[model samples]
Target chain A: MRALCWNGVNDLRVETVADPAILNPKDVILKVRLSTTCGSDLHLIDGLIPTMREGDVLGHEFMGEIVDVGREVTKVKRGDRVVVPSFIACGQCWYCQHDLYSLCDTSHPKPELQEPLLGYPTAGIYAYSHAFGGYAGSHAEYVRVPFADTDCFVVPDGLADEDALFISDAAPTGFMGADFCNIQRGDLVAVWGCGGVGLMAQQGAMILGAERVIAIDQYPERLAKAEAFGAIPLDFTKVDVIDALKELTGGRGPDACIDAVGMEAAGTGLQHAYDRVKQALYMETDRGTALRQAMLAVRKGGTLSILGVYGLMDKFPLGLLMNKGVTVRTAQQHGQAYVPRLLEHALRGELTPAALATHRFSLEDSPTGYHMFKHKEDGCVRAVFAP
Target chain B: MNPVQSDNAIKAAARASVTIGRPADELRTLWLDPGTQSRIWTHFAEVNPLDGRTAEWLARGPAGGEYRWRSEAVEVGPDEIRWSSLDGADVPNTGQLIFRPAPGDRGTELHLEVRFDPPGGVIGEAVSKLFHIVPGEIVRHALYKFRALALTGEIPTTDPQPAARKGGADR
Candidate 1:
């Protein structure tokens, strides 16, 4: 079977590899139909995330048809079209029972590898590096999904495959971000970065009753997408983002600020250069431009919803967060908790995430797709691969 | 995979544990069940019952070294089991398991401790920065697998899979 693999830093290739089989009693083999690139995947390709092994498959957000099922799987069987969450979860774990699927205990096969850095391991995710659970990714012709009932959500009738794909990750992640904000009536939400996650977050906030959503980004296409999504777009390159956010919110700051631009934030100042230099030298593990701005642009008592993935960064202004009485909530998305609703939303035409699929490629050309997605070439928000 | 044993053996102590959502009595029953060994400890050492309170153990390292020993149960209770290696065994070892009720109704807190005279020291046994607790770290991971089997009815693994190794496969 042909699959895209990560060979080295900034290196990717589509290769023929062994097809996947059901490895556990609750596992299922999915014949991948659509696998999309994610912003978080860039961390691995750039070598910022060092846990990736050569030949490791490199995709996460995907939807597919179940071709096989292990003995213990009884919920959805072969021929079921489902969207699988990136994170693998055993629904019986205490965390899963509590709807914190990402914190599921029994899913990560190699806990020893991550226990040191994180003190505890989260759920294993498909095609993510070893630190996340080195499961084969969905970029392949077929991928194995463990605890199928817990991780795979059936795509409702009338939801197109392209529309259902982002429900696997981007939509739920953005929904979880808004859910974390605890948004109330008339709340103003400011989201940094107009990439897939950022755009979804704006829509999520609006759905959850936020009166207005402001999206920040430097990319014109993404900003235009945000505008189309009914969010007020703020281009960071043309205006002082912090002041612009303040001015837009009547000098009170946004009621909730979302940093969707994770570790690889595009910034415009000396601080951005400093973070890049420090990160290159391994003195720090993340660039904090977007996060820093979000911290400053949030109201005194607002919620800081961090949907972005982060490792470690220097100069975190904990003092400012504490002094302002801000509540911070962040996690790998608990997609299991939101997928059902997201599917309904997609069916209702409330969520149309397929627009994020600006480019498409065959599984054999996934390397080139990733290249465009990484460089954001041709205004590609996400590069979708059909196997 | 465990490393090959060295002639210059070293004394090592490994301690690991997990908390299962089941009660201590249930866990005790599972621990004492004859099938539990094969169920959770697959691909590691095998324990075979010898007498009523003794078990013969055999372990084969990945690098082709075999180890044999027998352990005699010294102490047993509803919540605890303790054992020690019989004299003159290839590996001198002591193992203890304690099952106590966890706070806030989370379930049983299972504590496992194993001290052994290993044939190889830290460097050869495990190439990890956590070498000081390398064997213990391995034990901790095994304990999680045990937890997985008990909680989810399966042990998670990603082994014998295909990948494009450097200079080996076409892109």
Candidate 2:
């Protein structure tokens, strides 16, 4: 089977590897149809998230057709088109029972490795680093879905593979971000970044009843996409974002602020430079420029929803957050909880993530796809791979 | 009179706690179940319930050997269980498991404390440390595994399986 393997930092190759098979009684094998690049994969490729080994497969957000099912897999069957969430979960776990699927305890096969670093192990994720689970990713010709009855969601009729692929990851992450905000009538929501996740978050906020959603980014194409999604686009390069947000919100700030830009955020001033230097030196794992701005631009006593991935940030404004009575909510996406709702939204034509699929490639051209996605070349929001 | 300090008379202790998202009674039942205990405490080679309040167990020792011990429950309650080794153990040990309600509506806070007298005392402790057999680490791992099992119904491990092997491209 041909799959993309990460050999080292900035090095990705298409290699023939063994095909995936059902490992557990509740597992299913999927012949991948569409797997797309995510902003988080850029972090992996840049060597920010540790514990990645050579020959490790690299992809997470995908949708495919079930090729086989294990003995206990009852909900899905061979020939069923499905979209599995990035985070693997056992439906029976306490966390999963509580809809906190990202924190599922029984998914990460190697809990001992993460217990020391994260205080407790998180749920296993497909094609993430070994620290997460070492589970094979969906970029290959075939991928395994564990706890299939719980994790695999059959795509509804009339939804194409492109529309359903982002629902597996980016859409759910964005919807989860908006859901965390608990938006009320006529509330203004601000989202940082205009990548696929950020754009979805902006749309999610609008769908969740935010009167207006402001999308922030330096990229013209992304900001344009956000505007196309009915969000007010704010280019950080042209204007002072904090002041602009304040003026736009009439001095109270947006009722909720979302940071979709994760560890590799770009910024203008000395603090951004410091963060960059620290990240380069391995002293920190995140550049918190966008996060800091979002924290500052949020209304007092309002919600700050962080969809961005962060490891550690120096000079975090916990004091400011405390004094302002802000509510901070963040997590890796619990896609299992949101997929059903997202599918409904997609079916209703309220959510169309297909536009985010700006480029498509064959499995053999995955390296180039990743290269284009990494450099944001040719206005590529995401490079979708059809295996 | 000062007692002579023997080379084989060293005492070590470890304390670790995890807040499991389950009721105290539920956690206690799971902990007291021998089948669940053996599965969660993977270091235990065997654990046979001798009676309602006692168990004979074989723990994995340094260099792949097994150490035998018999533990009798000293105190048992709805929220806590205390036990100690009876006699004829290679390294005498005593342990207590306690459960308390977490603040708010969270769950139970499971606390564990274990103390053992090393076979060769200070030298035994040093040798165990050299062999990467720190008692504190062992207790910590057990406590974590216990929490995971109680909350997730299984201890998570990343050991490769046949279906998910990380094979080279050349293969």
Candidate 3:
């Protein structure tokens, strides 16, 4: 099987690796149809997330057909078209039962490696670093899906393959971000970033009854995409985003702010330069410009929902949140709890993730795909790989 | 009169605890189950239940070595189990695992204490450390794995298997 392997920082290769098999009683093997690059994968490629080994398969957001099933897998069987959530979950765990699937206690196989760094272990993820679980990713012809009965969701008949792929990660993460806001009637929501996740979050806020959704980014193509999704686009490079948002919100700021850009946030000026130097020196793990801006741009009693992946930030503004009595909610997406609803939304044409697939490539060309996505070349939001 | 203690006394001991989101009785049953015990302690060669309150086990030591021991339950109850190795064991060891209802109905608070004396006392301890087999880490990892297994139904592992271990080889 040809799969994308992460060799080192900024180094990816199309390597022939052993085919995946059912490793557990509840596992299933999926013949991958579509696997796409995510912004979070950039964190892995940039050597920011730790514990990546040589020849480790790299990819997460994907959809496929089940080619094999474990003895204990009952819900879905061979030939079933499905999309699995990126976070590998054991459905019987307390966290999973409570709708916090990403925090499932049993999924991380190497908890010892993460205990010291994270204070406690988190659920394992596919093709993420070993710090999460070292599960092989879905960038190959075939990939293993553990706890198949719970993890794999059968894609509905009407949905196209491209539409179902982003639901595995981007759509669910965006939906989870909006869900965290607890949006009331006519509330205004501002989402930072215009990538797949950001655009999905902007759409999700409107779908969840937010009267106005403001999308922030500098990319003209992404901003245009957000505008097409019925969101007001703000170019941070041109205008003072915070000031512009304040004026738009009548000085109260958006009711809720979402930071979709994770660790590698881009910005101008001395603060971003400081963060870049410190991040290069290993003193911090995130470029928190987007998060800092979101913190200042939110209303006094607003909710700041962070869907971004962050390790450590140098200068976090906890004091502002505390003084303003703001509520902060953040997590890796609990996709299992939201995937069914997202499927319904996709079926109804209320959420369209298919538009985010700006480029397509063969499995062998995944490195080129990632390179284009990394540099945001040719206005690529996500590069889809068909194996 | 006080007895004189040896200068090279080897008491490699460790204590670790985790609050699992399950009842004390449930956690006790899972811990005592032979199959669950073997899965949680993957390094062990075997864990066979002899009687209702005793188990014989073979633990994998450094350099493909094996250590045999038999343990009998000294104290048993709904919330606690204490066991100690019999005199015929290769190395002397004793351990106690306690389960108590956590405050505010969170879950069971499981506490484990293990003490063992290696074959060559301090030298054995040094050799074990050099092999990346610290007793404290072993006990801590075991306790954590137990918590995960008890709460999540499977022990998570990133240890590459036969299929994924073939580096860059096309099938």
Candidate 4:
């Protein structure tokens, strides 16, 4: 089977790997029909995510057909169309019962399990690197989804893979971020970062009844995407982000602010992680500028939800955060909880997450897909592989 | 594809807790027994009514065996619950479940602590860091599971032991 993988930092390759199979009673094996590179994958290729290892299959966002299922998988059987949830959860775990499946006890597959579990190699995902979860990703010809009955949502017969793929990760992640930010009808929401997740966050806010959605990013293509999604786009490189957000909010900060930029925001890549290690750590001014800016942009007592993965960062301004009394909610999207609802919306044509997918590649050309997405070459916001 | 493990080795790994300042081999002798082991699995496997379809899956044991039945009662103090696993699999990772009862109007508090013990040498250090957990986070999972089960009184899903089938070995 042919699959796209990252051999190491900055080294992505398309290689032949063994085909996946149903090794557990609760597993479902999907023949990869459509899969895409997440913005986090760019972090992996740029050497931003230090824990990514060699031969890491680099995809997590996908929607495919269930070509096979384990004896225990009754919810989804062979020939069923489903959007596999990215979070690998044992259906029985406590967190999973609460719909916090990403934090499931089984996310960490024990090294001792003699039989292969379902899902990719990492914690329980299709194609994220080892740092997140070593699940074999969906970039291959076939990918296994663990806890298939609980996590994978069967796509409606009419839904296209292109339309449903982002339901696996981006759409729900975006929605979860919005939910954390407490989006309300007629609320003024500001979203920083116009990447795939950011765009979905904007849409999520709109779906939740926010009257005005202001999206901030430097890239014109991304900003344009925000505009297409009915959001007000602010080019941070051209104008002051705070001033623009304030202007939109009538001198008050936005009712809710989302930092989709995460730790990937240029200089302060390590601040969130480092700040946790030490108290009152001093940071270079530009490193956590976006985070600080987010604090200023969110109204007093309003919420700031961070949906990005922090690789590591220099310093954090705890003082300012404390003084504002602003609530902060951050999470790696509990994809299991979001996929089913998001897929319903996609099937209804109420949301279109794959609108951000601007480039396509064959499994053999996945490295080029990664390169283009990383460099934002050819205006690529998201790229997919047709295996 | 499955191979059998020696009884002694399985016993050693079950009781291991690096944070408790004990060697892996000594964990079994100190904190675990069949009764306590079943309690943890039953607690983890119980269901919640608010959880719809998945709740049914939780109540039903896996073909290997679901977390089917168990009874736990605090014997010595509010925190110490003597438990037994009837049909489901036992908690294999660690066996020490500490419970602290409520002093006033607050309900009884239970703490199920599983301290991870890494393999020997530098490799252990790396594993420990990768699987970092605050004491609160550990207690939170245990108490939350217990609460869910106590309130719902049934396992949530039909298949409590969902296995990672294909890619479990790739890592």
Model 1: what TM-score?
A: 0.90
lDDT (0 to 1) per candidate: 0.81, 0.80, 0.82, 0.62
lDDT, model 2, position B171: 21
Q: B1-171, model 2: which lDDT tens digit per residue?
A: 224354233336667787777889888888888776566556434668777678887776667766788889999898789999888976677889889999976688888987776566644465355334666566676776777677545565433422222464312
Clash pairs, candidate 1, are: none
In model 4, state the lDDT of residue A119: 27
* Per-residue lDDT of candidate 1, residues A1-387 (tens digit): 888888898888888887776678898999999999998787677665556788998889999999999999999999999999898889987888899999999999878777876778889998778777888788888888889988889998898999999998999999899889999988999999888899889889988999999999999999999999999999888999888888889999999999898764211112433455464754233337788889989999999999887765556989989999999999889999999998988898888889899999999988889889989999999999999
Q: What is the interface RMSD of each candidate, in Å?
A: 2.5, 4.3, 3.2, 10.7
Better of 3 and 4 by DockQ: 3
Scored against the native two-chain complex, candidate 2 gets a DockQ of 0.27
Worst 10 residues of 2 chain A by lDDT: A265-274
- Candidate No. with top lDDT: 3
Clashing pairs in 3: A109-B156, A109-B157
User: Model 1 chain A — which ten-residue stretch has the worst lDDT?
Assistant: A265-274
lDDT of 4 by residue, A1-387 (tens): 777767765877777666666655677788888998887666556554444556666678887888888777767788987787677776564566667777664454321221122221223454444435456788877887777887778888788888788888888888898888777666898988888888899988888889899998888988988998899999888998888888888888898889887654221133332443234233224426667789877888888888876645535676667888889898677887777778777777778887987999998988888888878998898998899
